[model samples]
Target: MKVSFLIDNALREAVVNSCIGILLKAMDIECKLDNYNFFYSPSGFDFFDRTRENIDLTLFPSYNVNRTPEQLSRAIRTNSMMVATHAEQIINSALYKEKLNTSAKSKYSKQITSHFVWGPFFAELLMTHSSIPADKIYITGNPKLQVSTRLNTSTPNLSPSKSVLIVSDFSLGDMDDERWSQFKKRYKANYNTPIHRHYYEARRKLVNWVLTASERYPNIHFKMRIHPGEDRAAYELLKGTNNISLVGDRDFIEDVLDSGLVFSYSSTSLFEVLVMDKQVFNLDLHDLPEERKGEYFELFEWVNKSQFMDILRNYDEGKVFYPSSGRKKLLEKYMYGGNQKAVLRNAIAIKDVLENRIAQYGFSDFLVHYRNLCLSLVKDKAVKAGIWFNKELGLQNYISTLANRRKEADLNNPVRLNPNKIESAYKIASGIVTESEIEILKNNLYEIRKEKDGIYIDF
Candidate 1:
């Protein structure tokens, strides 16, 4: 048996996928972990679909609930049992349901054979709202959270904690005029409330507040971590300030571990910080009337810029403490992160499907698969020709986000695939998979394989 994984954010998924690959190898099953672009590419061309081409199962991280026909079409083309695990777990309950409602509820949800969830919170959401069967959802704790905890323990001697880490999850209206125009028009047509509009206004207010605060207090060091896809040109003012420094690209845990106080709004990273038992202040940037905040905002004692400064003054006087009880309760409710390692639990679930212990209900039949394959072959020639022409003309920037998903995808995601870092995480072994059996194969591309002495690249 052979299994494959679709790895998007390499920094976070690399270790988890590698560990799963090793576990499957122990079960005498082959595994391949490939980037989304690389996995689907045919002979180094664009818009091709060769996923699970010669493999049994493919674990695609299906982050969004609503998928277009074009999106679902590729899954049909996989020609193998496909499993889905939502990479970005929900933060905003209101927006999450909307994102889940489209074709996912009507088609894509049932098409997937297995759905790995973080816990009951998401499981219930999928079953109730997305038309996914209860049996299909596996409540494995998030692999990212599990790997994050392991990374935290293995390497603790990081830089001294900074005064404050402002983690931004805001996608502002500050992109190139064309993209921003499209974004606004889409939101205006679809949303009931002006969701993006409110976020933009609040974002400017918060940024200005932070800039003002940075100048006011020279002693308190401030660090800003923005999403990887964001245009950095918007943040050029920070270079002039002595106290404020923009964070470099690194794992989310590394930034969190080095920060004394956490401040964020509208990001799932808040859950990650809570899992680490760090006390985080919810930055109240909701400036609109009847604003619907995420479920997480209720957990923190939110404050404005002045209140944030007061808290910092209190922190300097040794009056701050981590919230252990809050962390425990929230983790239980959302993560289902019981004592057992999440990575192992997730691997076992995948292994069960590979061994035929559990059966999947794929939406497509054999005839549908054959038709899709024919369409893809015909489609690829045109895409390949267009790509060749576009590159020659140096018109790469015009490509939409879909094709922009290649290695250099500017999704504002900072974490990247690094073989050495993955080995470090595995060397700190999560029990079932030992350190000796797993090695990251770094020939031309990073592929983690399990063997005593050989790197398996036969696929």
Candidate 2:
């Protein structure tokens, strides 16, 4: 039997699907897993042309099967059982609503035979929110959590460093279409400001706080890890600080393990830090009212700039501020369920599906596996060669030097402001602010236009 796991994102989803592919193979099931970017294309029909007849099942990660008409028709023609497993633990209320609403409206939910979730909390959430049948929801804990637990156990001696790690979210950057729409609707009602401007405003405050803390305590290091979708150029202002550094592409687990304290606005990494027994602080500096503070603040130890600064001072003096004792209970309730052998359980469930003992699903080609293996080997070797070349020529440092030079040149150039240019730039920068605010910003910029070489506007 052949099974294909379709993936989009590589960082976390690819890792989880690869582990599931191994588990399926151990259970004598032929599984082909790889990143498929077809979902991002306009014509979703392209995915059907890439597969063969013997493939019996196709699994997706937290995606509705009938997103497009072509997708629904392809599923019907292939007669393949489709399943979806969430890639991350759901924490954001907007995301939860989006997923459940999409799942409820999906016409191919029956063909998408099962929905594997992280824990009982997610299962209950789905059942309570969506129209998907209760039996189809499976509590197969997240594979990433299982891997993280194992890595943490084996690397227990990895001591923490005296550095503060900032786990950034994609909110500070250009958001996708769906997320943009949700943000507009959600924040417009609460704060009466544009969603992107709100994110930018909050991020500016947090960055300033970090800079102030770095200046106050030159002995401690501060590292800002940019999110995958974030444009590093957006944070060019923070460059060249004495005690601050921007993290480059590196393994997140290793970075987290070595961090003394973790800070985030609202990232899923907060859960991972809790599991690792590390100090975590949420930078909750939004201007929303109390009722609109969101659900994450209820669970995490979110603090304002003053509180965070105090905590930093204490940490610099070799004192740590541990989270309240109820954090572990909250962790168990929301993220993990104390199951370390989730991969084994997932494997057994897939085995039952293949054998027709559980919900009927349906793979059988030896050459397909051989061809995939050969391609993967070639890709792996090519990656290794590129790494070796970069190290031998010190290409990374050279690239960094070039980037810094360009940034310096841009910083030295004074930005001339006009009414039309200001309006255009503000629209591009603060996607979705009111007309009144735009006028206010223009007037403010006019006042400060001649005072400095480069104008810096902070809302």
Candidate 3:
């Protein structure tokens, strides 16, 4: 059977979904997955349409950026079935809502015959907001379940008791609570203006917390693994600490499997950690929204205050909380709708809905178990063509340019924006903003007004 998958962009979060495409091929279905930015303009539709036919199925996960299932469905004329996951991730952002609404208005919404949601929350949200039917809801566990590759990477040689893993919180570049507060006072006293966005907002402070926890507890060593899409600067800053080690590799499930405990700040990684049935901990910070506050607090048996001393004092001896034995049954009811391999199950379900009999299928015929293989092999040429980018290029400034490459390749460099270099480049340009070098740029420079002839560098 022929199948294709589209993830729009290759951000770390989206790459996590590549397992579905891989699994399809393993089941002996032909598949193609690519990072095509289908939302740029109308002309972009052809790239997606060309791969639609002569295939048994199409999987479109990670469409959070701009494209909608409706838009792509109408462009492709295929008798092959279509199955989509992560339907809820699309509307979770304020930015995506605008794009989704626009696409829905243009007749794209009506064309999508089948789409699966992340969980009950998203399933309910979509039905309430759109004309979609109830049968469309399928609790397909994410392909991330297949993320056990890391577990295989380390085996009898690695002792789980000797290692502990900490997955840091999700962060916006401008959302540092401490940095934003300081920037506000500095801005108001000097410019008499209030700062709107948080400045110095990387996950740097959490590294300190990690160090403190490590120092306090000597029994189990600590390993730090930041989100894959995150830049190297966040990890580099922590490198100076003697005790902590950085794991920047892309594999997620395997890394967690090798470790005994995981500490996260409201990351979806918690789901995978639970899937592994390992001890999980949650850290509390101040920048997140209220409703989201402590949402995952109940999930972990372990919880800690944000204060360094308090965490250091209590963390080592703290006991981890586990969801009840019945918890998995409860979560699976809403999360997986009984089928853990939701993508595969959803395709089978779709075939059942369209036809009648349900036949057994497998990915072995189409996909080879090159378990030792790296995705870079299949993705390298595309990376050169604008698919994936690495954070290793510039350690100091990885946050600024780590994943920005339209395609994945090593040749790309961060467009340097040093103050002196900018001044020279702008002096010769026609309408550039290099008026003065002595400028106090806020986090969100575009939001600030120029009092004098100060130059604004929009990043």
Which should have the higher lDDT, number 1 or number 3?
A: 1
Cα error, residue 122 of model 1, in Å, equals 1.5
What TM-score, to 2 decimals, does candidate 2 have? 0.67
Candidate 1, residues 3-101: lDDT per residue as tens digits?
777767665566678777776676578876665543222133333534536566778775343322333445555545677778866645544544445
How many clashes (backbone atoms < 3 Å, residues ≥3 apart in a chain or on different chains) does model 3 have? 20
Clashing pairs in 2: 1-363, 2-363, 56-362
Put down candidate 3 lDDT per residue, 1-459, tens digits, no spaces: 665555432323233333333333343545455332331111211333453455455555533212333324322434444454552242233222432343352232333445555455555555555544555445444434423323333333256355667786444443355654664343222222222221123255566677666677665567787654445675665576555778745345546766656776656566666655665666653354332333333444445455434544444455443445664454453354332434344333333334531212223211221221222233333333332233333233332233333323311312212233233322322121112211212111222112121111111
Residue 186 of model 3 has an lDDT of 33
Tell me the deviation in Å of residue 287 in model 1: 3.0
Span of 10 residues, lowest total lDDT, candidate 2: 448-457
Give the number of the best model, judged by TM-score: 1
Off by over 4 Å in 3: 7-29, 36-56, 64-82, 87-108, 141-143, 146-161, 174-202, 291-302, 305-330, 337-344, 350-459
Ordered by lDDT, highest first, the candidates read 1, 2, 3
